[model samples]
Target: MAAQLSEIEVKGVKIPLIYEKSTLMPAVNLQIVFTHAGSITDEIPGLASLSARIFNEGTKTLGSVEFAKELENRAISLSVGSGNETLVFDMSALKSEYLEGLRLTRELLRQPNFTKEALSKVKTDIKASLLRKESDFDYVAQVELHRRLFEGTPLEYPSMGNRESIEKITLKEVEEFWKKRGVLRRAIVLVGGDVELEEVKKDLLSLLSVLPLGEEGELVRYEAKGDLEVKSVIKNTQQAYIYFGSPFSVKNLREDSYKAKVAAFVLGSSGFGSRMMEEIRVKRGLAYSAYWRISLSKSVNYSLGYLQTKLENEQQAIGVVRELIEEFLQKGITEKELEGAKQFLLGSEPLRNETLSQRLSSAFSAYYRGLPLDFAKEELHKIEALTLEEINAYIKEHQELLQLSFSVVTAPKE
Candidate 1:
């Protein structure tokens, strides 16, 4: 029931295949992920996202509505989405409809609706979405945090792009970006559910043969800037939206990552019982909830957290956040906290792996992070045997996390 890794050779290029067979339902899911083709590689802000939207419009021959109807008739779901570091074409259909799904996927890839009409429609949709986000204080705060942390880097730009950026995007640019990024070289195939591996491999060879050979671009890694600066935005809001981040250097991902997980869980990730929630919410009454997350990936690494409180209590909440982080760095976590984190993380293993999609995602994460396919199983073993001293040592070593940068959005003085 575990996802396994294999490879298919097309045009002398090896494409990674991550798959798992599950007969629990008569359904299948597939995701063709392109590396180095996401927002990080965009020469123009939102080019990657814009290209994905056009791909979702179906083929040039069928047009959007008719193409969608064909898939709906077969009960197939096909879509393209972009992330910070990759673009994915995802499909799901019944076991019987899978062949039709493959044929449709090829059609989309070979003849994407890159016309002026499609570009105008997608641009209008994205611009409206961007306008709506202006009213979301949390979104505004998070975007500001990224801007301050990544300043000159690609990460600074919003993935969905501002209205101006979307307006500047054109059909020709979208076509070029898609043609350059969607290639045999960048593809990683993930297919599973109610199919044999041999049959899947044979079908994939034909489905992927249509992809043009493209030059792979380099994925640049960005580290959170340790500025210790507070940037405030004036918004007409009752509550102050606070977003905080700092650098978290992961020296050895495989050896020290489990410790980071436990440390992060004990510090801020676990709700109610976590140190951040216990101090900021339970004791000080600064906010209803507080949390923190450690994000480590091939393209970026950082510690991010957020909370909201009354505009009147804004400064006090920020101070409490700083004090808690400094205290955590100085004192590390207690044995009780460590034990609780371990118990919770270990006990929740089954829930995390209960479904086929979860298994596929876990496997993809392992491959994406340049770790072994069995890394998840091995990580559980490490967490179960981890010692308090070891986790504390790891926590104390990450002093860079305390160089916090704050992005606060609050109402103007009344």
Candidate 2:
């Protein structure tokens, strides 16, 4: 059975909690959504990610060792993470010690020390990561593609921030950013597993009722603005990495967005026999692999995809991929393809919702986007009811994808 979910407000902050009973099991999981703290709102490139990474390192009330001991003694696991547009605090514990686990997670978030020592270590780690990224063509192609498409915006840079940016961001800046971003504003807390709704609600209110309602920070929502042009970073490498994309905008939970998803699968995201793979790999044998997919979110909308091939044939490989996209856009999709894609999605739903963690993540995303907790399930219904004509029409009308953009990291001309 699906977990029972309820919505409640604590001190005017709406939160969602999912309840599932396991009489034999004694664990509960929590996924706290920190919406405004995502990297999109970062004043510096990687401040949000770095701050989130070190958030659980220690607190003013208790040092790192003590915090570790608290969790260890209770058999709890805690993790802090941030992506392009969201920060999350995830914790799990035996039901017997769940309250203590919650208390410690709350303390770590509410009163981090931001010690110079902790900051130094984290900076070193981030720097090492950035250095490693510099040598990776895959990372280079991905970052450069975003830079080309999202220039002059926060999304233009990497979520981890670049070396110079992360190095220059001071402890003071991180703390200030945290003070403003890490609050009740645009926050949705989701918990699922072996617990009751009321007890979790009561405990959460006690833990965070007094948090300052911080500002909802801003970013210019991403749009497709670039032209069909290839931006290249000439690296001394054996293979050329290529990414093709165009501006794509469809809000979360929309009926058409579901159609767009099916369209994407039929066009490129589906493996092997899909259009991109069939043309660029199987038929021509130009590259070992090629794939495509739509990248959508509340903040930005775009199609992003990648393939790698021998440097000498980089332009040829890119040409074939573009032709595939152009043809797919013009021809739309067949009834057979649409039906297959729908079944692929519908069959995959159970696998996705098999655990409390996955359901909590989905519910949190919906709630973060100001949709009801049940929006994901409803959207699937939309997908199921979609007709071939409807999705094909969606593809036909969106010819703007023809003016797609490209970014390549390739070996320099000999």
Candidate 3:
């Protein structure tokens, strides 16, 4: 399918880039990202997402149930989700429902009630969710990892706050968070598939006109301390979940970042071919499943690689993982491994952009992170262009920088 990219400027708000695809099925993907500083971070880390959820719960005229029913009636899927840096509200619907969907979305964004009842329900739901997380070994491990890695920083807290924080939150607090950070800043709205550009622009303006523009707040910059610490969570279970890693931040989409990504895939990310999978699962039979993930934070340019394994081989597993990591760091990756990583990354690129939702979401994230709208495409190119020497150099530079953190879920020894 042929694609054309274009930009639209309305008033002071500039819609960065839009990719239009001519298809038989009519579909529109819109991404609206709001930029607000972390004022609410002091109270609750994920206050931005909490505020977005409350806004969707009810507006001035529609109650929670009514709003949901209206959305269902239109066969529209409205999703309110966020990342560490921004809150994103995405909508997908047929051409016929686009106008109404946009209208309802605008109402929810501009006229949220933030009523006491809504706040109570949200807190109650969050508390219940937290209760359920207590028994989840993987969740425990991940949470402990963040706590150790980002100690004393606002990013140390989970995106979903703890039960005590949630319980203490009030409607007034929610309102204050909204007023301080939710109203206006830089907002990007993306609409794709079978839509008139002019109409979409008008719809966006109508909703955005009600929002007041003010001095954009300074961006919150997070710096990762190179200190690595270990933590353990005691629980009465047969298996334990363990994670360990170090701070690897990508500041400017550098070659090191790309090499690190490729190296991580060879080390753990590709599921079957990764070194972690081969050693932990295939060779040793130590874990039922073992893999690694590369988490990138655009605002802070922080990236971390994590390895999750079961408790039976917790100590041994960490030891073996560390040894392999040390070897990679010292000797660096081979030509064969680099080639395999590149192929795996290039093969997976298409999957990332397979759906309209993925495309729009990726575009929004790229723009939000101060990257080109074609960041994904660029990433693929970068991966393809990587050399074995560069990958080896990255490993040589960062091998000793690794950190270890633990979360154990096991019964006490007799």
Candidate 4:
């Protein structure tokens, strides 16, 4: 039987639940998020990501191979990934297999094996991936940009600890880290699709309640120092990948961040309609692709734009991008542009939460950020309410902070 969506209070914690009655085969998506445990503290820099990686490596009763085979045989999809401030574990399976899926998830969370063999495989894979990243121009540029921006903060370290760091990690260290940081006391488990609220809560509590509670700690804050400026490094390739931005904190703007986002979209985010696309692709054809994005963190915020073009035309592309940004900052986007960007945002918003998987993912994101469940929708409403004058005013306020950064990969001259 399919269950209806409802909110429930469990042991003083308010949990949001979503359920849909399906005529087709019953399917369920479950996401569990651990808050306050995902921080990149100086002591265990990559602890969150590492813990998530080792979750499925092995469990109490199942060895690595056996555990993997079990999920495959059951047609279960399980994923564990972490971000700056949250660690997430997601499971999707048919309702008929729901009990089995929950059992496996509980065992994996409570009793991960963290064997030496599994750790070795993870280390080897990470090292190979890092080597591959070295040859990627865009990757190199983005890594450098983060290093420069974050500087001394623990957040500066790559999510996948470097080769040296990963090599140093041992099974014992992983176990200790897991014990100290993997407590599910503050975790939120969301079950979507055909699921009974009581059943879901009962299952989660059975596994999560046994874990000992730990001291609640504050999230690490990273402060960006100095003025934003352009930095470049030369690499051997035919095209250049450029990135530009300045210090802009999303937390500071809150709901008002919509204006900044809309401005960015009008300026360079919209592939074809964006100003950068007009100048760099349509008018001059210096590059076939150009776009910009805004990245927000608890303590850090910045905008980045990039394009790829031949070595000879790289300089032209960079110049045009800079010029267009300068013009946008000075004059601001027109009323028509703002309207179009808002409509694009409004139309795109629904697609983001259209599916069970997406909604569950979004719920995790909200829990991670300490945002209201309706933050996405509210943000869209804010975007629709923004006026051209306000956006232009925002551009003027942020113009002086704009900094252009570039990384170019070019082929050697014949």
Which structure among the candidates has the greatest lDDT?
1
Q: Which candidate number would show the highest TM-score if scored against the true structure?
A: 1
lDDT of 4 by residue, 85-193 (tens): 6677788899989888887887787777677777777777778898898888887777676667677786667777676777777778777766765654556667776
In order, what lDDT does every prediction score? Answer: 0.91, 0.79, 0.68, 0.70
Q: For each of the candidates, give the backbone clash count.
A: 0, 1, 2, 2
- After superposition, the stretches of candidate 4 with alpha carbons farther than 4 Å from their true spots are 1-25, 42-47, 225-229, 251-254, 367-370, 410-414
Any runs in candidate 3 off by more than 4 Å, and if so which? 1-22, 37-42, 226-229, 301-312
Worst window of 10 by summed lDDT in candidate 4: 1-10
lDDT of 2 by residue, 1-414 (tens): 455567667667665555555444678887777676788888889889999878868787687788888788888999889988888888899988888888887787778869888888889999998898899999999888888788888888999999899889888998897788777765667776677777877888866664677776664576766677988999889999998778875634465567777888888888985888888888888888888888767787788889999888888998898788788878887888888888898888768877777776676666656666667788789899998778877887777777778889987686
lDDT of 3 by residue, 1-414 (tens): 423345555456454545555355776767666665342254666566566677678676888889889989989888776566666677877888888888888887777868888877777787888899988877877777677667787677778778876777777777876666554455656677777766666677776776665546666666555554455777876776776656665635534556668877887788878887888889988776666655665545433444445555667877777777777678887788888888778998889888766777677666666676777887888889887877777777764346544444455655
- Over 1-414, each residue of candidate 1 has an lDDT whose tens digit, in order, gives 788999999888999999899999999999999999999988888889989998889899999999999999999999999999999999999999999999999899889999999999999999999889999999999999999999899899999878888889877788789888999999999998999999998998899999988887788888889789888999888999999999999888998778888988988999998999999999989899999989988888899999999989999999998998888888888889888988999899768988898889888999988899778889999998988788878888989998899999998886
Candidates, ranked, TM-score? 1, 2, 3, 4
Off by over 4 Å in 2: 1-24, 217-220, 251-253
- TM, every model: 0.98, 0.94, 0.91, 0.89
TM for candidate 2 is: 0.94
